[model samples]
Target: MTTISRFTGARFLPMVPALRRAADRVPERARLPVAVGLLCEAVLLLWWLAFYPGLMSFDTVTYVWQVTTGHWRSDHSVAYDVLVWLSLQITGGLAALTFLQTVALAASLGYVCHGLRALGVRGRWAAAAPLAVVLVPSTGTFGIFVWKDSAYAIAAVLAFGACAHLAARQRPLLHWWLLAAAMTGLSVFRNNSYPAVAVAGLVLLAAMPRRWRRIAAATLVPTALALALNFGVYPAIGVQKPSTSSYYAFNYADISVAYHRAPQTFRRSDLAVMSQVAPLAHWSAGGSNCSWVDPLMAPPFDRPAAERLNGKLLDTWGHVLAKRPDLMLSAHLCRGRIAWALPRNDSDIFIQPPVVPADRFGYSRPGGLMDHSRFLPALRTDPPSDGLHSAGVWAYTAARTPELTWFLWTGSLWCWATYLIVLRMMRRRPLRSALALAATTAGLQVAVLVATPAGLFRYMAAPVLLGFLALPLLTAAHPADRLPGADPARRGRARAAARPQSAPPRSGAAA
Candidate 1:
């Protein structure tokens, strides 16, 4: 073969012209503006890695250990761990692992930039937004954290974009299938991330044309398989018993007890006390009167002592609700307040005396591991709290010449508001998209608080991921419009709009 033909056969040939076109399309004068953005990203990334690598949060260490040991059976989704394992094998040390982490983070940030560019943002501007996202001092700041959140967020964005592309009829079957696999992988990453995958599946379903029965078929088959793997088949095959902590058990116990006692109202305090004790009773040695579910709710509940107290409290709550009218309203409202104001920490952590005691029984058990875990120590020791310490801003403000905490809070609230506004706008034509996104965020937050052993502000990262993706699109001027430029190559393909609107003719067919 001629040298020219051999060169044409190389992989780079396909992408070479595209690169040239990008250069041609971007005005020569735009280089400085683009360079400024790239330089800013470099500076911010360096600052984060140097000072607060991984932000050293509580869950990070467990993940680090998991990666180092190549032990992943305990983890739900092992993608990040798998990546770390591969990177470590290649690099062979902690320093290499750290560098690998930054590289992975940069790649994920680049993917976010790609999403932005597809939405009409210039490449440089798109790139800078993810940096701004990283600099926002919220969930994105944890980008370097070894936990699955960063990886899950990246997977989610990729899945969302792929599903969106399929919806737009831009990508092929192979791409959608790959995206589906990633979504499934993400579902197992962290307990909270499962809902995002479920929502992504819904997006895929919505994107497909109704005539294609296979779309619904495709969506349901994977989810069904996942269910079988998680609940039905996994256990039967000895994979692992589904870990059901007492947290969810308690919620169910509370609802069930309330249901039985509902006809005879109760004072809110009465209900609260009853709700707290029922789970304890269920787990009590002699307290068979409480349901099995109560035990589940009180996984850490002390046997006889917890059950005996819970039974009495349940009866007391039922009696009080039966008797007091005004107290009922007070009790119902109080329950709502408690639910809303509930701490984002594992109740088990609070169970320990000396608050942040050296020995607290966490999910892994004997529970002292709880206190030893990364975030738990900070939660116990980090004082002045958000309100008292003004979120630790005295030093930050001195350095930055601004109240970073205050600014972060204000900016977050504004971004949150913008997210809601976008949801409202999308609700008209794409209500399912808006609702699915909203539900994924809100439902997971509610579920996480009720189910998980740990609850931290960082737990809210999944929702924030969606909010950032939707933000630029929300802020942008155009709606339902294609990006500004057409591929000059595709200009020839742009034919009569008057053509029949069913599916386009198969490739190579004459009009």
Candidate 2:
């Protein structure tokens, strides 16, 4: 009876040999990269099919307009506009553009796994790392979104991952080139990234060892070029200066701080200048944060009027900050909490289709605002398939729940954690190179805290995504092995001992 049962089971399990054969075809070293690539492709396809074409916010509309027309505005990064224009030229639609973005994201993540493998992580854990990334709600969902923030976040991840790889490997020329390219993309993708990269470069310069000093130049040079392009080259070509009103956006916290702490300090003349854009009555009602006096809500003033008020706006803000530095600091802390503090904030910048005038988009579906026709033909004019859309919505909703939102929103916290972990590890070994990379990421988070207009989730995306991607690198073992001057003889012995010997090494043999 036992022999008969065994024969029956063998006959039924016909796929066992084929499964083993297929698994055997993938080399052990290649498995992680292969799994990561396939997972990335699957996610991209799923995102495309569900949201088909792509998802967009108001910023997406503005960017598309800027690209379609030659008119350049400083409100949006012309550098990013150029990328969008290039994508449009190549794919003639958003699908291909998103597909390219997916590839970049996957490649950046694969670099992380590669760095981990180099740092002595087991192959199985390295391969499984991508799964953790995909399962993390914020990390995977942002890969599908079509915003400059999304592009900037992806570029930032690549730049950091490349830096990590360079830090962990002895042969770093290739990684250096990769880091340079990624940093260049990062610098151009967002206006705010300039300062972040600059800060990171400084951190790298200060933290890296003497031998790795050249890598500092890699971060600084690209950042300088990006600054030249944004400030010098764009105007040389034909881009118009960004609106003066845009500068006022930075003064929201200032205005709020003044109003809340010392409303009497604001001279009547100061109020008059501000009234040119926002209604002083409404502003007074709104008080010391963006909720009352958002620069976006400020009415557009003609050039002469705007220029005159812009001068006053700057002068008044400077006076307020100078006179009441403490209040300014308090306001910044209060507003920045939404971005840096844990437990998440209520601001959601991921609103799809956007909320504009109903007539603007021609659609009458309940709350539809902008006309769907204004978008490129490639973008889906109607909603996606119900099943796919529903599933995406459900997942997104789940991700947004308070418990998960805390993790999703605390990207800055993650950077600080990375910095602390790297700093701790450096005490016992030569990990300054990796420490520099992690510090750069932390610096970017600090930049967001200092410079972001409000605590919007989108503003924190890059730091959040980067912090998660840097995990394997931060938590890796054998920190000394990846250092620049570690003894090769000792490393060889360690590796030999780590592997199982076939027999006791036959006394006199090479082993």
Measured by lDDT, the strongest candidate is 2
Best by TM-score: 2
Where in model 1 is the C-alpha error above 4 Å? 1-48, 51-53, 63-105, 121-125, 163-169, 207-225, 232-300, 303-455, 475-511
Candidate 2 per-residue C-alpha lDDT over 438-484 given as tens digits, one digit per residue, 9 for 90 to 100: 74576567667666666567777777776665555544566545434
Distance from true position, residue 430, model 2, in Å? Answer: 4.5
What are the per-residue Cα lDDT tens digits for candidate 1 across 350-457?
111111223322423454434333333322223323442333233223423223322232222333543485465455344333332333334334434333422233
RMSD of 2: 7.0
**Candidate 1 displacement at residue 364 in angstroms:** 15
